[model samples]
Target: MDAASWDERYRGAELVWTAGPNRFVEEELAGLPVGRAVDLGAGEGRNALWLAERGWEVDAVDFSAVALDKAGRLAAERGVGLLRTVCADLTGWSAPEAPYDLALIAYLHLPWPQMAQVLRRAASAVRPGGTLLLVGHDAANLEHGHGGPQDPRVLYTAEQIAELWRPYADVLRAEAVTRPVTDADGSHAAVVVLVRAVRK
Candidate 1:
């Protein structure tokens, strides 16, 4: 979706996503060394706010201005002064040269070369030995799991992400992880691809 579409989605009063960071994000990053971090496609800045609360200087980037505005307001309300929001299209966005200890791309789905392009941009942001973590709905989730984007074009596999990162980083973990979900349709498991790499 474009910025306008996302803006419309975020225009409602209630939060679109959960108020807290993604489960995988908190679990994987809680023990890592805290430093500069960036949350790409940061809808409403949940992960960014969490990082700020934990004392990491965070840049939350998203295309939607409305989402960024909401994030800014929440940061002020919670006194999280370290969170910064950037409104830009990720495909055309570039981070400062090797400035971050960690770069996170969560649930940001795009097709093919665009996905590769964004991944390259994100990888470029991490200093050597810094971490790059990506999480997204797995392609398998469409038929075997539950509740994610229905479009297969945007869904990806763990191996695919790891392969894309091969030139710039060393893969630490790459797998399809299952999480329990309880929606109105009853209990189900959502499969998501999780990949962690360290910049070379």
Candidate 2:
């Protein structure tokens, strides 16, 4: 969807996503020391706000201006002065040359080539020994996952993630992870591709 579409989606709602951060984000980054971080495709400031509160100086980038506005407000309200909200296309936006302590690309579902381009850029932004975390809808999610984009072409796999990060970072874990989805009837599984790497 385009920025206008996203803006429309967010304009009506006070919050497009949950107020809390993503579970995977906290799980992976909680113990890490504070430093400069970038949250690419940062929507509604969940992860970026969380990072700022935890003492990380965060650059929150997203194409949606409306979302960025919401993010800025959330930051101010949360007493987090460590965040900078930027509105830009992650695929084309040239990152500042300074390396970051962490680069986070969560749920940015583009076609394969575009996704690779953005992922490479995100990885390059990370300083040596810094962490790069990517989370996306697993290709297998078409069959098993819930609450994700429906297009399979935009979905990704662990192998694709490993291949993308192998040259520049040490691949710690690249795999299809399962999440439990609870419903009125019962609980089921959902798949998501999670890639955690540390720049070499």
Candidate 3:
């Protein structure tokens, strides 16, 4: 969707996504030391706010102005002072050099080439020894899992992401992980590709 479309989607009083951080984001990053971070495609800023509350200075970048506004308001409500929201299209946005200790990309679906560009830029923003983490619906999710985009062009595998990060960082973990998803029918598993790496 375009920025205007996303802005319209976010115009509702309620948040589109959950207010809390993504499950995998918290599970993987909870123990990391506090430092400067950037949450690319940071929808409503849940992850950025969480990092800010934990003493990390975070830049939450998203294309939707409405979403960023909601994020800013939530940060104030939570007394989180270290979060900054930037409105920009990730396809053309550039991260400020290798200054961040951590870079997060969660559930941002785009075409393969554009995604590669964004991920590479995100990786470049991380300083040496810093971390880059990505989590999104795996390609296998369409047939073998539940609840995610069904488009095969956008969905990717862990290996594809791992290969992209190899030149810039040392891959630490790369796999398709299953998470529980509960609906009216009960609990079901949803497969997601997760990649974590440390900059060389």
Candidate 4:
């Protein structure tokens, strides 16, 4: 969805995202040192807020004004004001150059060239010896998963992610993973592609 679509979508009476950070974000970053970080496509700032709570100075970048407003409310409620919210399209944006200890994107899916370029920008934002991570619904999820976008152009595979991120950083791990999910419908699994790397 575009910014206007997301803005309209988030203009709901309720918050669109969950209260806390995404599971993969928490898991992958659990042991990483808290420092300057950026959460690209940080809808509602859940991950950014989480980082702030843990002592990281964070930049929460998203294009949706509605989501940023909700993120502000959430930050206030959680007593967290360490996040900087940037409402910019990532295609034309580059995260600050090599100044961050960590850079991450969660569930931000774009078509191939844009996605690749964004990943490059994300990597460039990371300082040497710092980390970069990306998590998104796996392309294979279309056949086996329950939620997430259905467009293959935006979906990605483990191999595809590895290829994109390799030239920019030293990959710690790259894989298609499965997570258990339970809702009113039933218990099931969702597939995701995860990339963890350190800037070279």
Once fitted onto the true fold, the runs of candidate 1 whose alpha carbons sit more than 4 angstroms away are none
Structural RMSD, model 1:
0.9
Model 2, C-alpha of 15: deviation from truth (Å): 1.1
lDDT of 2 by residue, 1-200 (tens): 98999999999999988899888889999999999999999989999999999999999999999999999999999899999999998779777988999999888999999889988998888999999998878999998768788998898898898899999999999989887878786887789889999999
Error in Å for residue 84 of model 4: 0.7
Model 3 local distance difference test score: 0.94
User: Quick one: best lDDT, which candidate?
Assistant: 3
In TM-score terms, candidate 3 sits at 0.97
Instruction: Quote the RMSD, in angstroms, for model 4.
Output: 1.2
User: Where in model 4 is the C-alpha error above 4 Å?
Assistant: none
Cα distance off (Å), candidate 1, residue 25: 0.4
- Span of 10 residues, lowest total lDDT, candidate 4: 90-99
Estimate candidate 1's alpha-carbon lDDT, on a 0 to 1 scale: 0.94
Whole-model lDDT values for every prediction = 0.94, 0.91, 0.94, 0.89
Instruction: Compose the digit string of candidate 4's lDDT tens values, residues 1-200.
Output: 89999999999757787888899999999899889999999999889999999999999999998898888888888888798888899999876654899998999999989998888888888888999898999999999996889999999887787777788788899999998878899998999999898888
Q: For model 4, what is the error of residue 184's alpha carbon versus the real structure, in angstroms, after optimal superposition?
A: 2.9
